[model samples]
Target: MRTHWLSSCLVLLITTLAVAQKNTQGISGQVLWKAGNFMPTIGTKASVPKAVPVVREVYIYALTNDKQVDAGEDAGFYQKVNSKLVRKVKTDKKGRFSVTLPVGYYSVFTKEEKGLYANLFDDAMNINPVQVQKRRWTKMDVVVDYQAVY
Candidate 1:
């Protein structure tokens, strides 16, 4: 009787583990450089360059998408709880990036170079992120105004 009970318990535990693993999903996304300021040539004395610089070294964070959790406080919450690196990725030569993460809602974080570099979406990316669905394989898009801090 003792051996039969132990065997049954082991089987139950294995089944639970298998079921949990089956529910996991993979999440992914890409990053791009925001368009540069396009001043009208007709009005300006000097024409601005049409090409934009590539952004790099942007860091991403994951957070729970709950009603009580203020979306505006995501960065601060991540800093307090997930201060360590969740994942690190860089933009390719064409300013494209892809990262694979487990299914979960996440907030995007971008690091802009402190020097003469100009990054527009630094604060916004740090502020709030849209709730990401985590069921199966998923993909999303991210844009950065300034280059990521290397």
Candidate 2:
């Protein structure tokens, strides 16, 4: 009798959990340069001797209302599952890039720099709408300035 009741309860709990799960979509967007494009024509060397264009890794982070658990959080809900040192990708010949992020709320930003270039995400991070549907692709185009706080 007890075993029967326990099995029934377990099945009910499993069913409830399954029903509560929702399929989340992924979002992808591109970052393009507005005024100062940074690519070159064919036969151009990788590095330009005179001027060093914006050469750094750009990362897209998923956000939940500006509150997040860092490296000390437990491996549960609201945990950083895919946290790692994202590789640096250069912009296209036209200073454009694209990245795919999991479905959730997020804001796109770049790291800070010094001297002529300063950290952009310091004051305000460039924010945009993020919506990832199961069968649909949410496209966003972002333009980042030289000095903007995140």
Identify the leading candidate in terms of lDDT.
1
Q: Give TM per candidate.
A: 0.43, 0.38
> Residue by residue across 68-100, what tens digits does model 2's lDDT show?
323223211222313332233445554455544
Off by over 4 Å in 2: 1-27, 34-56, 64-90, 112-129, 147-150
Off by over 4 Å in 1: 1-30, 35-55, 64-84, 115-126, 135-139, 146-150
State model 1's lDDT: 0.49
Q: Who wins the TM-score comparison?
A: 1
Worst 10 residues of 1 by lDDT: 114-123
Tell me how far candidate 2 lies from the true structure as C-alpha RMSD in angstroms.
Answer: 15.7
| Positional deviation of residue 130's Cα in model 1 after best superposition, in angstroms | 4.0
Question: What CA root-mean-square deviation does each model show from the true structure?
Answer: 13.1, 15.7
Q: Distance from true position, residue 66, model 2, in Å?
A: 4.9
- Per-residue lDDT over 1-150 for candidate 1, one digit per residue giving the tens place of the 0 to 100 score: 999999999999999966754575544455555455554666558745343435566565554233323323322322222333467677776656656566555555555533112122223343334343454545545555432222
